[model samples]
Target: MPGRFFLTDPMAAVADALNVEVGVVGNEPARRNIAPGQEIVVFDGALSRMRWGIVPVGRVNARGRPVMEQIINARSETVFDKSAFEGVGRAVIPVNGWYEWTGEKRRKTAWRIAPKGGGFLYFAAITDVWTAPGGMNVPQVAAVTCAPNGDVAPIHHRMGVLLERDDLTVWMGDDLDAAKALMLPSPEGRLEISEAGDVDWDGV
Candidate 1:
C-alpha cells in the first residue's frame, strides 16, 4: 500500500547528499502527490528526468498506446526475471519521503512517511524506453517494492527500496543482476517512519 509520496527538498539537496553533481532538475517544484506516468527526478549519482512507469517497447494496445500493466511498483523477488524489466530498464529514484495509507477498507486513509530529520533517500527503481502515443521516445521508472522492514511494516505491507550510500554505484551499474540484488529490503535500522501530521487523502 505504499503508493503516493513526496519530495520536499530541492533536487540539488538530494544530489549533495548522494555526492553527485546536480543535474537537470534545477528548482523543480516539490510534489505533494506524485502519481504514476509523470516525469520524476531519479539519480544514483546520475540525476535524470525519468517518467514514472516503465513500458516496454512493442507492447502497445489496440489504440497504439503503450500498455502499462500496473508496473508502478516492481516486486523485489521477481524484478530480474520478469520479462518486462530484463533489458534497458534499470534505474534509481532519489526521494525524501513516500506515502502509505491505512484505514477501513471502505474508507482509505493516506499517510505521509518521511525520515526522522528529512534526509534524502534513494529508492531503487527500474526504467524503460517507449515510443509515445505520438511516436516520441520516453523513459520512465517505478519504485521497487518489498516486504517492509522494522518500522515501515506496521503502517503497510510493502515499502519502497531505499538504498545505502555504498550501494548506489552498484545499484545503477552495468551489471543488471548485481543491481537487482540491491532490491532486497533496506538494511536493518536504516529507516524510520511516523504518522504524518495530516491524513487527508483527497486534499492537496
Candidate 2:
C-alpha cells in the first residue's frame, strides 16, 4: 500500500530535482504520514500543483463532509475504466519515500521504500477535478499502484507506480497510452527498503 509516505526534503530541494518551480508549497512542513483526503503536492514535469484528496464515484458526499474513501492507491491495469480514475487524472507525486508495515498489530515493522542514496521517489498518481451538484468544484487525486516487485512482495503485495526523473514528461503527458505502459513495478534493485528511522507520523 502507498497509504503512508514521507516527503522529508524541503520544497526547494524537491523542486530542483524535478526542474519545476517551487509553487505555493513554499517552506511547507515535510509530511511524514500522508494519508488520503488531505491536500498534497504533485508535479507535472514543468509545473507543480497542489492536489486535493480523492473521493471515489458514488460516494462524493457523506452528509456534509467530503466522502473520503479507502482509495489511496489505484490499480494500473484498470485505471482507464475504474470509476474513480476513468478519464484524465494523470499526475505524479515526488515524495522521498513510502512506508509499508508488516508483523502483527502488537509488533508491526515499517519499511521505508526509496532509492539507494535516499533520493526522491516520483510516485505515479492520477487526479481529477469535477464540479459538484452544488456547483462547488471538488478535486480528487490518488496514487497509482502496481504489483510489488520481488523485493517488495515479502513486505507488501502492492506498491505505488514508481517513476524515474527522466520519465517525468511521458508519465505526465497527454499521451495516455505511453503513460499506462510505464505502470509496471520498479525493476529489481531499482529501490531499496530499509527499516525507517524514527519519524513522527503524527506530526503531519
- For candidate 2, lDDT tens digit of each residue in 27-60? 6787787766677778765444544456554533
lDDT of each: 0.73, 0.76
- Best model per lDDT: 2
The deviation in Å at residue 122 for candidate 1 is 0.8
What residue runs in model 2 are displaced by over 4 Å at the alpha carbon? 45-52, 58-70, 130-135
lDDT of 1: 0.73
TM-score of predicted model 2? 0.85
Off by over 4 Å in 1: 57-70, 198-204
Q: Model 1: how large is the Cα RMSD against the reference?
A: 3.6
